[model samples]
Target: MVQVIDGDTMVVMKGEESVNVRLYGIDCPEGNQASGREAWIFASKLADGNPVEVQPIDIDRYGRTVATVHVNGRSINEELIRSGHAWVYTQYCTNDFCRDWLKLQSDSQGARSGLWAAKNPTPPWDFRHSFKLAQATPQSSKPKAPPASAASYHGNISSRIFHDSSCQHYDCKACTATFTTRQQALDAGYRPCKKCGAK
Candidate 1:
């Protein structure tokens, strides 16, 4: 049996030990990124509580087994690409098998399926690289100042997401609608954003 950790990672019970496996030749979006939760949900539906056969390729630097997984003869990695939930990891995929995987991604893109539905979707690798670089760079060497008290809720007319004044997305150029209270935002037909948990 297998338990999905995310779109591209899983934990499998091997004998008495649990083994961490990273799906080979595919990279999914990060957890906090756009469509990241959707990818995870799709992957969970495919893998959770299901019996999967893993073909180990190598071990990653993080000690996760890099492998190809099959669930009832369907290649999970290929399926992810075909379904537009993941990208074929060209940098790490050097084998001849990658050609077919790349083709699958192209087909999905042409059909505008899944992540391809977005006009421009950021790849997980690029997102991770940018995140790492931001972590390494400091905004200021001086001591950080405490944030002010959060104000009442506000809503973005375009996005239909509501948050308090201190929320990251609050009061942006698109957030034209103002609410005196959280309930007012809800009454205005705005939902809480997952990032700030407005409700």
Candidate 2:
């Protein structure tokens, strides 16, 4: 692998191309979330710069290659769950192995491993949703723009994603729609910018 982006995401050298791979059937905490750094360190030690096997599963909405990765004949995806560094992503895990993975997750939770050490740790999906809700607060009751350049929220019409000023893509080529508040973008059916975690 060329780089371990996080606990469950990596950039691997697939032939001459660098492919972004999302580990299948499991979800790890985001880098900024609880137990996130520990999970990342463990995954990096297990997989980074190692010649590993990638078992292709499916492509995700973000265009990432979803796969099960193996290092030294051991499955990294399964290892993460076994170590309590990840949770079984039941929403997308349709394969038969998901049942076994869920059992492992339960065992980890019962043992208070990793993020489960917290009495009630927030799931990554729920964390993301809460973050969006927090950011969705309207700047003002009425919608009005001071100026085009001063707009706080920017939307990419093509991708249907909105970015805040903090994002590098806030003023990207496709970001023609401008909003005074994040709620305006959300009301228009635009999803938050994943990179900046903008709502």
Candidate 3:
């Protein structure tokens, strides 16, 4: 079971037969990135081409076993994420590791390790769609950039921005004006300034 096929998939030998197992509760990036390959390497090292204790929860539509794999008393799913090899997948997670996995992802992201190295790395699911679309259509026109002056201040129209800094990007989109400070932007009913990358 030590050979990694991809970020989230592995091949394990079960009673002399090979079985494909999709790791549960976590999502690694696609194979196109360095982080994706790192994830595969980490999983392979954890599995060590040996029989692991796989507790299958269900069979996914792709017929792969969706399971929590344990090797040497450690949960491979958690190890992959905590070690910065993978990300916790909230959309399809079925285990208690979901929250912990998310925390691990956050920690990795904060450290700018693996996938976090990219300025904006695409999620695996989203990357899949983008890949399909790319295959269907050849690269052509460049996307048009938004106008710098296309912005408006919110004033009293929106008060919620004052409390939540996350709304900055949305406010920047609506106002078309970037702000120097989050507080100033929020006071103007413009959320955080996206152009300045206020976050």
Best by lDDT: 2
How many clashes in each structure? Answer: 0, 0, 7
Order the candidate numbers by lDDT, best to worst. Answer: 2, 1, 3
Model 3: CA > 4 A from native: 138-199
Q: lDDT of all the models against the reference?
A: 0.75, 0.77, 0.61
Least accurate stretch of 10 residues (summed lDDT) in model 2? 143-152
Off by over 4 Å in 2: 140-165, 168-199
Model 3, C-alpha of 190: deviation from truth (Å): 54
Using TM-score as the measure, which candidate wins?
2
Per TM-score, what order, best first?
Answer: 2, 1, 3
Q: Give one digit per residue, the lDDT tens place, for model 3 in 78-125.
A: 887777777778888956658777887888889887767788877777
Give the local distance difference test score of model 1.
0.75
Candidate 1 per-residue lDDT over residues 1-199, each given as its tens digit:
6756557876788888777788998998865466665776787788867788999999876667899998888888988899999999999998899999999999999999888999999998887688558545766675343333223565654466887644777646655344445665675457988888975
User: Which has the higher TM-score value, candidate number 2 or candidate number 3?
Assistant: 2
